[model samples]
Target: MTQSQHMQIQKTVFIITYGRSGSTLLQNMLNALPGYVLRGENANLLAPLVRSWQGLRRSEQAATMRARGTPSGPHQPWFGYEAIDADQLGQDLADVFLRQVLRPEADTRAVGFKEIRWHETPALFAPMLEFLQRYMPEAHFIFNTRAHEEVCRSGWWKTMDRRVVLDQLESAEQLYQDWQAAHPQRCLALHYNDYAQSPEAWQPLFEFLGEPYDAELVEAVLGRKLMHMKWQKPANRP
Candidate 1:
């Protein structure tokens, strides 16, 4: 098959969430699928790429303004900027990310990674997500969340202020809800509290991705613990 055809058939899924949201477990489950390659965190590298793409788009707008009044000259500040194709640059940047960062093998059918730092800047979340959808091939997003109280008590979160962490978690989940409401077909919101113990809970996720749900595979994936701390139910009466 041709390269273009290969790319067209390949799917991409991103696990978007904050830290200690059981994303590593989700990543492991996805990687277990046939011909799938879901990677771990990359310290949120795509954010900077999105920023650079936005900067290029702004330059392209400036170039358009410069074209209306003056004749083109090599010495001009925005002279060659007119030739810059922001859309093409966006695509090129996305391709570089796919080829270099999330390097898929020859037989790979789907590829993506889980990232926890997306909630760091609430304002940039939408733009970053939109950019990915615009440039990536058949991109789908899975917004993973967890119980705020449990999350704030896990890992490094114990070192931070409780109210501040809760606020961030709430803000991030709200962004997920807003985006999912706007584009239901492309987004899936999964809560750790709902699926941490049961492999059957992930059936809807496989259905959303148009993948066959294998119970045994799911069971095996769930059997292995990927996180440093296992999720424990709070002792408070239900």
Candidate 2:
């Protein structure tokens, strides 16, 4: 497409946080803007490599690494210090589906993703994060958080948000926290309780996006008038 006929420059806001940490709520909230789309938590790509990363833990005390040269593998990692294979590169199929189904018009609005298994191995997945950073240069990110206790409680519910909740199968939270602290301005810290209970505190979300908040925009993106879609009552609610 020509520059004049271009869609809104895409801005990816990575919602890197503990799952069930209110990403859906945030996704719903942000997509309300006229030129924004939310690609809910689709980081399944990192599933294969996390195990090997554990072997390298003791070597680097460095914070986060940067992707200096072009990653020479299928993965085409945006930026980071990881041994990636070019064969590892694959487009987020979700992006293709979105462009085709949800955003056919390709509105001038930017799109973003809010998905993670934060309690999982974040350092191992750094390459993917780097790749995204390259693809979505306009991307800013939101790292949503909740007290570990609250996450546990909510995670225990019947319709547990598996994405937000840390499973017995995954790595601990300290690693996630450390990886996060490694990258500063690129992210914002948002708490689930704060976002759920007091929406006003999230004004910074709008500010970071360089847009004004629209009450209507928030409602539509959030699927309107519902606080926490009662998913089979979160596993075991009375």
The global C-alpha lDDT for each of the candidates, from Candidate 1 onward, is 0.82, 0.54
Indicate which candidate wins on TM-score: 1
Per-model TM-score, in order, reads: 0.89, 0.60
lDDT tens string, model 1, 124-217?
7888898889998899999998888888888677678999889888888888889899989899888888788888899989998999899999
Clash numbers, per candidate? 0, 28
Off by over 4 Å in 2: 1-7, 46-105, 155-173, 215-223, 232-238
lDDT of 1 at 64: 72
Q: How does model 2 score by TM-score?
A: 0.60
How many Å off is the CA of 215 in candidate 2?
Answer: 5.6
